[model samples]
Target chain A: MTTLISVPLGEHAYRIAIGANIRRQLPALLAEYTPLTPKAPALIVSNPRIWRHYGTEVHEALTQAGWQVTPCLLPAGERYKTLRTVEKIYDAALRQRLERGSTLFALGGGVIGDMTGFAAATWLRGIAVVQMPTSLLAMVDAAIGGKTGVNHPQGKNLIGAFHQPRLVVIDPDVLVTLPPREFRAGMAEVIKYGVIWDAQLFDLLSQLPRLDRMAALPAEQLLQILERSCQAKVDVVSKDEREAGLRAILNYGHTIGHALESMGNYRLLNHGEAVAIGMIAAGELAVTLGYWSAEAAAAQRALILKAKLPTTIPAHFDVEGLLALLQHDKKVQAQKVRFILPTAIGHGEIFDQVPTELIRETLHRLQA
Target chain B: MTTLISVPLGEHAYRIAIGANIRRQLPALLAEYTPLTPKAPALIVSNPRIWRHYGTEVHEALTQAGWQVTPCLLPAGERYKTLRTVEKIYDAALRQRLERGSTLFALGGGVIGDMTGFAAATWLRGIAVVQMPTSLLAMVDAAIGGKTGVNHPQGKNLIGAFHQPRLVVIDPDVLVTLPPREFRAGMAEVIKYGVIWDAQLFDLLSQLPRLDRMAALPAEQLLQILERSCQAKVDVVSKDEREAGLRAILNYGHTIGHALESMGNYRLLNHGEAVAIGMIAAGELAVTLGYWSAEAAAAQRALILKAKLPTTIPAHFDVEGLLALLQHDKKVQAQKVRFILPTAIGHGEIFDQVPTELIRETLHRLQA
Candidate 1:
């Protein structure tokens, strides 16, 4: 069964198609929007890992649909997501003579989607990119928004643009291949939607048949998770595409989350794990500041625990170092980092003037 | 006296302040629009050559107005306009810790403006950019439009974006320092404006006391020339910000001009000189194709000759090489190179289906 979600983003509007084994419908879905000429070239950019699993199937499907498809594979890892890797993709695009009419198919996790979307954004000023997110983390968060960029040496997503995709294809069948830890990481964002905006999703996850692995969940339940998580993202992004105001709510736990990830040097903690820890810090901060009830905070913590995500800072982490890293976050404006603290179980608010001593105390407690 | 021309591009609307000695008004004009924080850093990206002449004036003005100004100097020349140079500006921006509120001031010729604008576009996703074009070509052409880019190794401006500027400042007094040859090259674009949109401007240029050197013309006439040329650009760009339709008329001679520049390896011929030669070729092609009159073509050549601009292809230039270079142009869609051909003295239309044989014959005649 196929479920379609439409992201009405004015001129950059596109559709998100979610289902099982829907990868075969890729060409038909793309042709519905793209006025592709016969034999118009399409470059499928993927990592060796994902490509090894699904490369032949996607290649044959596109070729059979009359696309002159070429597979451009890259090394699979967050460390490889840089401008240098993007340059390699540029070389491939040029070699294939990918014109303005050409489309790029990004088929992998967040790293592949980001690097491919960025390359597509810049190639010939801008071109069409179709996001085929293979990981649960990507399908829920990274692939929905048109925010495409490579991490600069100085910062994450500091060098990028808001170039929307023509289509976002999320296949639950691909989730079966995703690592278990990675799947749990994606649940952090799922719970984030629940804490920040949707109380019903919070209840939905609490009653899930199983939250740790893909196999433990029923097919209908998995589809519900994908649809709800993606719909939450599409709703936020469609309204605030540039993250000017309301979209900042989407980064509910990202202030401390990014800092934790940076402190861990991006290798120690995956984005989901860091966000999970960050949400705990933010929830405690809210409870201490009297914005949210302690009882509600405990309930939120239980959901995170049930999802099997981390809710604590590292033992060796330094309070001062974490605070300093927090200050350096790109969202810091006028010397104060904006923190998205919970007002209720299903609502969050942007607090610009979070007292430093309070954040320091929160981290100190987490250290204990 | 300052002459202000407003480019009403709705949300992207900005003012182009043009006149003698307007560089002194940079601070006041900028402060009017930019809600600059106290001591906000402004990186002035320019060639050392232009910096040497007016750098102190701009620096002191902004510094006195409480702006923390940093002069990031680059080597002066068209050959230096590449992504490598843009990276240098990014480094400087990063080193100076330029935030979203920080502005990049492009202070040189078209090469400096284009490269600086591109760097500003990509830095921190994008920041504010103020164009202070020191060359006539930049003032009339490159600076006004939001089209920012760097030349790729394969083709000119293949990698770029459409990022509009916060303001454009054109100081006519600075043209006194412009070389005589560079001044004549600027006239090619001025004449281009005449042929493509303004017949009255063509008559105005034809009646100039002297068209070769800035010193030879009256001060008022210089202001008139700058006003009329810039107004032409503002008029066209205001209507079509993104080159979807009417804006292609601005590429009246750029199709052939870019091919010639690339074929010459961007060294032997400056942009305007290549454009001057390109205009003549396009005019003749227009006449041969019966789209334009012979009298108009001859009049166009006479004006180009009067301006001391090139009207012929180089002696050693290969026709096939030029044809091959034309194919690599970014404007080529469906494998057909689109040309902006003249319909009258002050009107041009996009011609996408010009036969290859006609292009070859035109080049053959030019070779003779």
Candidate 2:
């Protein structure tokens, strides 16, 4: 099924299609920019793990469609998302003679999306980046919106630019190959949408069958869920694309989730898994802050539990180390910790200048 | 003479205010963001040259006005406009605890203006960069319209972001101590505005008194010329904010100018001087292409020659060496070279696919 998602960015709005067998048609979809130039190169950048799976298909598709394709394989890992890696992308693009009209395709997960996006954003002051998301994490979060950026060693998503992709091609069939744990990690964000803004969707998610054993999600069901989540995001980003106010709601569980990711060395736990546990802590805080009734908090707990994500940080992780990392998070403004707390099912409250005492107290309850 | 030079960016129209003692009043003007919090930290990035002159005054003005201040001194040189230098500003902002709503003041010439603007553009995804230009070269070109970015080793400004400054504060009195040679180089761009966009200004320039004793230019007359030149540039940049079409006209002489700067060790000559010579070559190309009448071309040459700028490359420079450098210029869209050529006085054309044979022929003439 081909589902078109249009992010309403005023005059710059374009369509993103999520479906199967879409990789074979990118050359035709991107034909507009090609004839605009006499020679438009296609530079495909991905990691070794992903390239081994889908690289040849991309090469064959673009080559067969009468396009000059240059493939560059980068080593996969979050640690490789640095200035050095971004430089390598530019080096390869330059070597391959990728001109201004040339299209850059980021053909992997979020790291590739971000690295390529940053490279494209800065190359000649900006270029067109076509996102081909090959992972559930990328399809659900990283692939959408114009927020393309890389993680700084100090914090995740620290050094980046808001360079929107010209196209985002998400093939749900690719999720079939994702490990069970990896797929579950991405579900954390999906659940976040239902908890903070869609009670009906939350109820539907609670009723869905076991996710671990599912092979291919029915096209219509997948499209409906993906479209709704994207619409929720689109509505918020359209209102506040730069994360000033409305967009911060998207960081519902990220305050503690980011810290947990850093404390665990970003390798031990995936982002969504950390956010799942962070949501539990937020639920408890919501009740303590008197914004959420126990029943509403329980409803949120049920979603995470049903999704089978971690309810808390791993037993070995350091709470103090995590706290230190949270201090450096970009979300912390005015030198005081900030939290996006769930007020109730389908609602959120951004609490700025929240005291460290409240945060520690919330974390203390999580220890239980 | 607080002339409000309008940067015509429809909704986000900013102004370049040229007057005396303007720097002292910066605090009172920014009531919008400062009231967000008390003791807002600001990072003041300056080069050794400007810091020696007005650094403490600017720093003290902010701090004494109840705003927190931090100073980072970078070495003064055009070569310092690199990613490495931009990183130093980033690291300093981080170290100084510069936060959201905290502003960055760039107090120097075009290099300082460009890098600081880029750092501000990408800091925390974006921030306010206030341009305080100390040189005449920066005042009319670099300080207006929000194009802040840094240079890549591969090419001049190959890697950068299009960030606009919140306010551009031009204190023309600061030029009292500018060296004679540096001042002459600045006139090249000043004259460029006359040649490429303002016929009336061009007529005014030709009728002006002797430029031989440039140091004797009264402050009032100097301010008037700078104001007109800057207004012309701001009008173009504000309309085509990203150099898409109208803004490319601003590169009227920068094609050969940038290549010459890189090939000349970036020390023997100033930027304005190289552009002066580059503008002459472009004038020759325009005439050869029959786009510019010989009388108009000679008139353009007279203005530059009056400022004592070279009409051809120095005998020591090699044609092939410059050609090798030109290939690295960021403006290349494909195998065809893109040169922003002047069609007539006060008129410019953007040729994205300039015939290479024409460029090589132009190169040979410059060598001759």
User: For candidate 1, lDDT tens digit of each residue in B100-197?
Assistant: 66789999988899888888777777777899998889999999988888776676777777788888998988998999889998989999999999
State which docking tier applies to candidate 2: medium
TM-score of chain A of each: 0.98, 0.93
Estimate every model's Cα lDDT from 0 to 1: 0.86, 0.77
lDDT of 2 at A229: 71
Please tell me which predicted candidate would have the highest TM-score against the true structure.
Answer: 1
The prediction achieving the highest lDDT against the true structure is: 1
List fnat, each candidate: 0.43, 0.53
lDDT of 1 by residue, A5-54 (tens): 99998878899999899887898888775455445567999988898889
Candidate 1 wrong stretches, greater than 4 Å: A34-39, B34-40
Write one digit per residue (lDDT tens) for candidate 2, span B57-142: 88888877787778888877767888778878878877776676678889998888898888887777777778889888888888
Question: How high is the lDDT of residue B118 in model 2?
Answer: 82
